[model samples]
Target: MITDGAAMGRKSVGKEYPSHGSVLGGKPNRCVIHPLQSSMVAEALERRNKDWIVRTKDATDLIVQVGDFSFHLHKLAMVSKSGYLRRLAFAERSGEENGSSLKIILEDLPGGTKSFELVVSFCYGGKIDVTATNIAPLYCAATFLEMTEDLQQGNLISKTEAFLSYLMLSSWKDTFQILKSCESVSSWSKELLIVKRCSDAIAWKACIDPKAFATLEEDEAFCLTLLANSHGNLNVEESSEKWWFEDVSTLRIDHFVQVIESIKSRGMKSELVGSCIAHWTVKWFSRITSGFDNLTPKHLAQKLQRITIESLIKMLPMEKNSVSCNFLLHLLKLGLTKQINSEALSKLERRIAFMLEECSVQDLLVKNYGSKDTTYDVGIIIRVVKTYALFALKYSEPRVCIVGRLMDGYLPLIAKDTNLTVDDFKSLAEALPTNARYSDDNLYKAMDMYLLAHPNLTEEERTNVCGAMQYHRLSQDARQHVMKNDRLPLKIVREFMLLEQVKMARSITACESNDHPRTKTRTIMKVTKGLDRGCLTPKREISMIRKEVENMKMQLDQLQTCKVKLQRQVKRCIK
Candidate 1:
């Protein structure tokens, strides 16, 4: 019988097995080695003959052959903490088949050298399953190996994949993280391309910081344009909330103009152009208006003529009337005063003529006034024209002619027939008041009356007469004479009084109706008082009293009849 300690030693020795050393028969008293043990010993002896395998204190490096293939295993880390030697021994003893088919060659990797083959697999693999838990280890390994392709491939997957991609990409700190980790130029390019293609605002924001982009001119311009275009589609209030492009205020005007011109050159569709124009107008209205307003009339005319008629029309709908009319007046004024190129002046003239014909002065005013849709009142057109004429009259002779003609066609009617007389109209027309508060309809009416009063007037005569009338101040005596003769219509006066009475009655009724609760309370109190004072009970009380009196009277009447009969009998006996 073996002692327990001796049996335990034998079993412990049996359980532990070396990966390389032979376990075959050797010395029985020394340690009875099996046949497989002898084979392992022979392999170890052969491995010792080769200089490639290194045995160190921390780990072991071995080139092992299993089947046809060979693989390297670094021994700086333990192969198995629970002991692979024990499993190998058990497999040898049980004659069980080893699951591994590929030969694994163990080679020690020094601290400086990297296992780059692992990186290649990671990069080119059909599918990579990287999670947060494993990412740090993978990233460390990738970095140590200088795995540019793998890092870039990872970045591409992170950006292109669905929600997982976004989460991973956003998890990165900055562009440098991608740059440092990636090995290939193409991989780095892919990173940039992925960032550029990112549609999520948050993802894009994470990829490219505005400050970083600002250093690259091309990138900065691209980013600004992208942001501007994006902002254009957003509601004004929503865009204001983001204010993402607020830094764009620092861009020079020329840069901004270049951006705008580039966008325009792309052939903007109506909706896009409208949105862009709206955003531009809101962002730079005062600046654009002031700058454009400062340009010489000739310069403005040249610029205006260069633009397509369609573009000009689009601009018109977006601009304030004052700004639009000012631009138009500038072109017209330039055509009259400056010696501009004939072609340019001709275009301006054609555009102006087309606009006037299409947008008739009367029709525009009536349409705008009737709809109450315009920012400026309909009267602004008259003031704008008058201002243009006055300014033109001061500078050039042709302008005077143009002004005279305009007055003949439109202003004369405004002055003579409308409430604005020739003199009051002239004062307003010459002064060109900015606030055109007076009713334009009155001006139209006055002009109509004057035209009716003077029949068969030649066009030239009418022009001169209207121009002269602009200077003619009507005398107070004449105004009084006109007023005295123009008495209010009796029917109108009677109707006015009737309307006043009806309005007063309605007001009184409304006031009384509103006080109904209080009135009803007072009325109810009076009724209740009358009821309590026996006025309501008096009817019942009087009816009862009268019934009793009637009964008494009937009884007395019967007694009286009896006494009369007795007296009658007595009289008869005496007779």
Candidate 2:
């Protein structure tokens, strides 16, 4: 019996049991199959025995090396899992004609050792543990090895692709996840269709809810994590809410550019991109000025070298917000080196000209001036424009181009905004130094041309135009023309007439004083009526009030003179 036990153990040395069997005590019954137990048994046997594929590493076959680790893998097993290895194996096997195994080392695998390890391990053992730390490299190696969609080794290719599609690719459902994942993969996704597919998914998400991406705006971890590991511990609950102005450190320029282009292609609101870019650039500058701590890959000595400054500026997804100007300014600053070429200068000219032409300068001023952080934001813009203006002045041709763009855009785009509002005009009037960029005569000429081109405008349209003229501060000539002209909308003409009538009534009342109670009440009524329905200019309203007060002063002066005359008459009567 002892001899039989020893014999049985010897026979069972490398045998895989689907579960613990009855071999030790009695005749082995049919092994009860538990799916989980079977998997565990196979895994244990594959690791401990190392007998999945013959491990002799015969010089008669293929030798695979990864760094210091070397594997004496069989040609049949390696060639079966990877076409890349297959081609290398057979090509070397036949050509060398030496009876030695072909030794091939992998140097360019991402995740380096770990990446090669995952894919190489799969080729030998027919299975691998796909992990966050290893999935990125595993995907790269598997792709490089041409192990795609093949069922040759326990579906090795399928399993690797599954890891990429689910964990790596699917994680980009929101902006934060997309950014974080892209950071890990770096230039890998651009080599594959995964990132572009994810972008398409976001495009679909945008159609469902344009603001669905806004959640990413609030996530600081996604933006900061690449430089510092501090932002990594987000839980499922925290990641549920997911989401350019720019001082760009070129380290993450590829990822950042990819992200922005994705948003633009998906048709996200550009204002969101603008605000996010502003915040991101500030953070980047802080990290950079802090001695470039963890922001590695100093290859950025050639800033934006991969993409031209003008191309990048043109490519930036800009909304109609001032922060878009911030992005433009950053690109312009990068291009402001002393040795700027004309090609660069021309592209800069085209873009700066676009900024002056395509963007609503007057509208941007209105938005910026209305912003709560006007001093800081508007101040930054003023400095950026000043920089651009200095650049423009450097070349007389660019300067002319800049001026032409401003003039052309001012007429069709800014001055004649079909949706022009009183607030916008007021903003423009206030920002004359910032906006006009030309003589007042030119501004007035553009305004006149706009109105003339759209003559026979509807009553409401003309009223809005006239109200902007009346209510907001305008060029003196524009104000006078709108206030007094017969060719203007009749209702606008009546508004000024009513305002004048109201002013005269108030002046007469001030002369009469409170002693004339009826006149005082009547003048108040007229003043109230003229201000009704939002018609009169605010400046005109102030002028009416001042004239009334002035009329009272004149009346008081005349009365004092009359009293003096009366004193003279009384003296004569007494004589």
Candidate 3:
């Protein structure tokens, strides 16, 4: 009696169909009476049943379904824009019986129709092979879909080399615009390298179109430096046969300085400063120092003085000797005669002192000033003595004396209390002849001898002597020697003496005070012993105890008064 109506309905249709009334419906036949109507019915059934055959629009759409989730043909095209899918076009679909489930059934299409199919496949959740035509579109589509894996695959397929080649071959304006769109540092660097390798400076200059040299940022500096170095020898000679030098004046020095300082501040390893300095120095040395013969004495003196001062202050200490000492000395003498500022003179004096302190004394005495034998000229001796005396008086005898007897004559000149004004010191210094010849050690010794003979000198005088002795190359032995003679007005020595006296007095007082504590302790112990021995009678103890008891009774009376007041308030509130 079972008519098997479902089987008859399927068999009578004369189309291969899914088993009728199976656990679930079998695969739906696309060739049913109305093909489109059948598909609509299948789709509706899929919604109702929660399961149905997935019929893709095309082979590519079918492939995407097997590998990735269902997607429209347009989406797949966008995802594979970098040509990644195109490269995988012939790849076999795994877990299939025929080894190839993505075979194209319809091969022929109208012109541009192939692209239309790809777009459709993409829209139908199908992945199209990425090709040059689809790359850009795919990138946009993948980015829109937020398909990170697809985007990464596209990037790999695109390759930096290919992109750079495209940039080089494409329109310069377009390439620059594209580069500007890159946001990440890595992407920018990659693009810049490509531009550097293929394009000329003009092209790169066009890209950034810098209006002024100062407009360069750190990244621009890196790019420009690379460009400049690649061009080779920025200071190359303009003329043939090496007749004319490179015209580096065209290179903006201010900009160069800015760039170098920026790089140095950022701790970069570029040698821009060094290269610029070397080049500029070579070009400007002659021009800067030209017309020496025409230079006025005033101008020459001023220029030399500035150079010497700058050299002394800024040049490495080790290189001071490399400078012309004679030139420095000549300028110093001129400065003195011209009555230049005392500060300048003071600096010159320090420089000379530094040089003398650094050099061997015997060399100065023998090589420059001649023999220090007893036959030494009186003029030399007098000049040496006077020079030392001026130095000692101006600063202090002790500071100069520390250098020895060569400065002894300077000691007697140190005033008792008043400091010699700069003008006074300068006048005294100018009066001193230039033939000073005493050794430094001898000067210190003589100063010490002079101080010892002048014990009545004031505190200021002693301080001046100590200051001079400590000034330059003064030996420790000489310092101690000057210190031993209280006649040398050294404030440190006097202060030290006063400090020692104060400390000693304090110690004596402390010792005396300590004796008082011991005495008091003995008295207390004796009294306690007398009490224990009953030498102190109970009557005396009772009187002392009664005093303590009376004090406690007064404290108790105050507390009772406070309690009475509190009770009165409580009784009134209860009422």
Candidate 4:
């Protein structure tokens, strides 16, 4: 945890070190080269088939085997710097004869042979160059060998720790490099707190404003081209708040979570944190194919993805709209596919439900690639809709209506999936409040589509599926389509006809009342008693009722004929 006092303390020490990118690659000043010493070690290690014979005044008595590479060196020099080597050098070897060359096999050396070579060079008084690339593993290797100041003055452990401290305090990119390099030496890094310290540094840098630092050079810039408002600074073009997103997202999950928690604890804005999380998640999606299932060793890949998704869900900011609703929906789908923890999964659902209005039809159409499941994931969305309904009062009317419209657009798409169950479809359609939609034309269209796709449905199933829609709210064109749609249940079609007749009867009576002042006065009295709903005044209601009555008389003459034709057509279709 990088506390405020610690972060401020680091600021003064940071100025003593040179700015980042001054000593790394892409500059005229490259890191120091110790070619002669490097060649000495490389030449000795290259002779794997033969005993390594060093061309030195003293005969080499020690054979150090690091992986496939072996080095011929003096035991005195090795034992002096490494506590592990000192303990091993004097350990009894039962099979070995006296005066024979002693060989030590180091299979578990951190940083592998490349990092061990630096340790060997350090032991031999050769210059050891520490850079962002090698600092992490080098530190781990030195620690593993126990090259501490207690054994020798100005030891590898102390020197590397100092460099790591400087890198963590001063440079943003170096901290990321150190954390990435720790992947190969995870255990050692964690033990040494290198991972935690690097994560803290990154979190601190992210929480602080980038304008405090000098303009970054092109080589050090995280995304120079993408940062339009950066003016050569660290702020990203997407948003100034997202300056650290690209860099931090490069970290693997474990280290990424550490930094995220650190940042969260610093009281950074939840929306900024959420945007960063979403950015990281989107990057992960782009790398993956169909899913983690496509990876070799299916079970392991799925388990890893499940763990990662659960961690991400657990780390999400609690504030609303912190993440985009689209990302949340996609994450929810992935969570279901991965079978993440129920608590984390429910958290995702609640967040998505809170912002359901922001989602689109495509966003909700989470396709089920499972062998036994329906073409679309109706269950998850149904769960989300139920959750939204629970909190419906907390939301405004327009937002609820927007979600209803979104569901309306969504239902038609899912209805095309023949395997979708009527129960699932009906549950989702009726999940919202009764007043969620001022119009039911879209719902009617969806119900019609479902009926068309599922011609084998029982009459009761079709009635149940279409029952959620209000027939009176259907537009004139939708009413006409409904009358002609033979896939509809005869019972539902008859009910629609009855409702249409009632509406027409009301219209005719109201229109007639418009012509007679006495009838209109009676209509006004009824309206004063709050008989009408949703902004309908006495005059408007009476006129609409009279007009509907006129229409009812005209349609009644044809209603019987239409009903008979629809009933015969529906029965034929069912047959």
lDDT of 3 by residue, 1-575 (tens): 11112111111111111122111122211110101111111111011132112343433233333121222222234334424344444354442455444422212211123333333433333334432223333233323233333444323223323433443343233233223322222233333343233223223322232223233464354334333433344443211111101222212232223223333344322233233333443343334347542555867756654553333223212234543333334335445544566676666555555454334333223112234322211223233334445554454434443444323334333322133232322232233322332233444554455455556656665455444333234454553343344454434543333333333333333433354666445433433333342454544543443343344335445656766788899999999
Cα displacement (angstroms), candidate 1, residue 436, comes to 26
Q: How should the candidates be ordered by lDDT, best one leading?
A: 4, 2, 3, 1
lDDT of 4 by residue, 1-575 (tens): 22222211111222212223221222111122121212223223334463444445567788888887787887777787789988888894532468776888888999988898778776765655567778889888888889877776667776677667877887766777788889999998988899888888878877876654545663245333334422234434445567567777777888989899889888888988988888788777766664645755878887888999998888988887777776777788888877889988888888888777777777776666778788878888898999999999887898889888988888888888888888899999999998799889889888888888888989789889988877768888897667556687766665565555555545544545245657545533543443334597534544454444345567555655676788899999999
TM-score of each: 0.22, 0.45, 0.19, 0.70
Q: Quick one: ranking by TM-score, best first?
A: 4, 2, 1, 3
Clashes of 4: 14
Residue 33 in candidate 2, Cα distance off native in Å? 21
Better of 3 and 4 by TM-score: 4
lDDT (Cα, tens digit) per residue for candidate 1, span 1-575: 11223211111111111111111111111111111101011111113322223223323333333233233333212122112322333344322244322223323221111222222222222123333222323343333334332323223222222322323343322222222222222233333432222223222442234334234755455444444554666675544333333322222232333333433444433343334333443444345445654655856745543442223333433322212333453444423434445555545444443333233334323222234343223243443454344444344454344433443345543433323333444443443322221223333334435545555555443343334221113343332222222122222222223333333333333334454656545533432332233443533433333343344335445646776788899999999
> How large is the C-alpha RMSD of every model relative to the true structure?
35.7, 19.4, 37.3, 12.7
Give the least accurate 10-residue stretch of model 1, judged by summed lDDT.
Answer: 30-39
Give me the runs in candidate 2 sitting further than 4 Å from their true place.
1-60, 67-69, 94-98, 107-111, 148-154, 168-188, 201-251, 293-300, 304-312, 322-327, 337-575
lDDT of 1: 0.34
Off by over 4 Å in 3: 1-89, 95-173, 180-470, 473-575
TM-score top scorer: 4
Candidate 1: list runs displaced more than 4 Å: 1-253, 271-285, 288-346, 360-575
Residue 194 shift from truth in candidate 1, angstroms:
22
Candidate 4 vs. true structure, TM-score: 0.70
